[model samples]
Target: MIVERLIIADNQPLTAYAVEALSRSVAQEIHIEDLEIAYAQNKTQLNNLLRDGKKTAVVVDYTMFDFTNQENFTIVCDLYQNTSCWLLLSEELTPNFLRYVVYQTQNVGVAYKDASLDSMREALHYVMTGVRYISQQATQILLQKAAEAENRRDELTHTEREILKAIALGKTTKEIAADRFSSVHTINSHRKNIFRKLGVNCVHDAIKYALRAGLVDESEFFI
Candidate 1:
């Protein structure tokens, strides 16, 4: 049987080697579409590539440009809309971020950047078989964030609550900034306030607070 096509949307040379090596173990032929620092340069091409696949799996880096943009998110949503396979390669599995990516991706797969190559390969394999994949660390972080959010209920303000909602939903500071027409620094400041109010120290904690408080739903965040 022909293995499903695997496209790695990364702009790093190291990733080219890593993903290529990983794909070689499962796919008959590994194709690399290395944007190599200019990924966002050819938005049209990337959109076309995503739209062309029938049964395809795309692995995208979390910081891979503005996937949070409404239009871009729409394109990504369209790409994996009904394809049943997609994946995100994120630097960390913080619920605050993954929630957004997962919501956009339709929950295909979520792999951490620091995970073993075998784990990534396994995730790809699972998706091929119509099952979702999420790293262990990602899963734990998600649960913890949910628990923390629950524990800290009344300390958050209405706006702080909304910021937490956005963060847990996986919207980036830049995306939130754009949507709110505020500066990135301002969004970040809001994030800091969220952390303080939630009694958490980082993005992970804020996510837990948001989840626990029902500011954001569990299904809205993953990976």
Candidate 2:
């Protein structure tokens, strides 16, 4: 798909010029509006610009702090519904935060500001096709998000959660039952359910699951 117009929005002067140059080959085809400030910083300006421009893809710096991740995402989502968003990321951004961004928008691309122009081109090329483009670091962040989501899916019921934590604390079934005023048989049943839900077989495996799921502290492993 051809990008009818490319809007380069950045607070940095030199970076904006460089982006204009990089997009020259494509920009020459129709129009490429280079903004001297962060568009996400000024919603009114962005809205007005888009209202008059042709079908466009916004290449912007993701460094503006005034808007939150969700807010930024709302803008991205709104743009993606009609156009596209190509983001220039910041080194200071955490991987978890990036995962939240990925969760918000699908047809988007992002690269660190310090990345080479080739990297930027690669990102732009894919996002122009309505594909998700991201760096290796961003990939790792997405993987971490996936792993965390899996842990959540394996989450325990309230009673099962308590039993899981108690096991992580090195408590035996009989001891846990006494602590909770439950019978040994009831405790054993909960343990069995926990194992089945977590897809683990033994107490040790269950403890590991609890630790990964953040149901217990790492120090509890030694206890």
Candidate 3:
């Protein structure tokens, strides 16, 4: 795959310089031409650079950029179908941010700003080839979050799990009580316990947990 333009959308001078150098090395190895540093301070500039619809690879640090949120960055990425991104993350980035962006788009490659030169090169190569790459540090964050979520699911009792699933399936407390041959108060008590055990305050949070834990399928939720 040929990369028509390489855009470095970072503000940090040191890291941006490193990224540019590494990008140049990779570009030479892969024969990518027209490499230029397009410092897109905001979404508009970034959009203008990618307006031509050529196959462009963007190396960006979204945290430093003017994007309001990760979703906004994703919106820009989605707008440019021919553009791929390499997210140069900071050490302070949260796992939720990583999870949201990585899952929300497939054309993004993730690596830390402080990542090794080799890893950054690999990430750029993957992005240029239209393949997703998650650096070792980012992969650990995702894995750890998944494990913590799994452990939280394990804290729920079997009965609480059933009640959680029922709630996620949109069953009312009265309906669950009737189905289980129990009183409404009893069902309500189960709901409270389910929320407490899941460390959630509202039914919505519990439902999200249920969905993530595979306690209920998304289609079943709609049905």
Question: Best candidate, lDDT-wise?
Answer: 3
List TM-score per model, in order.
0.58, 0.56, 0.77
lDDT per residue for candidate 1 within 112-180, as digits (tens), equals 878886787787666544566777877777678656756556766777778778888888889989988
Off by over 4 Å in 2: 26-41, 65-69, 144-223
lDDT score, residue 116, model 1? 83
Query: Which residue pairs in candidate 2 collide?
Result: none
Query: Comparing candidate 2 with candidate 3, which one achieves the higher TM-score?
Result: 3
- What is each predicted model's overall lDDT from 0 to 1? 0.64, 0.65, 0.77
TM-score winner among the candidates?
3
**Candidate 2 lDDT by residue in tens digits, 36-62:** 222433545666667753555666665
Per-residue error (Å), model 2, residue 42: 2.6
C-alpha RMSD of each candidate structure in angstroms: 10.3, 10.8, 4.3
Ranking of predictions according to lDDT: 3, 2, 1
TM-score of 2: 0.56
Clashing pairs in 3: none
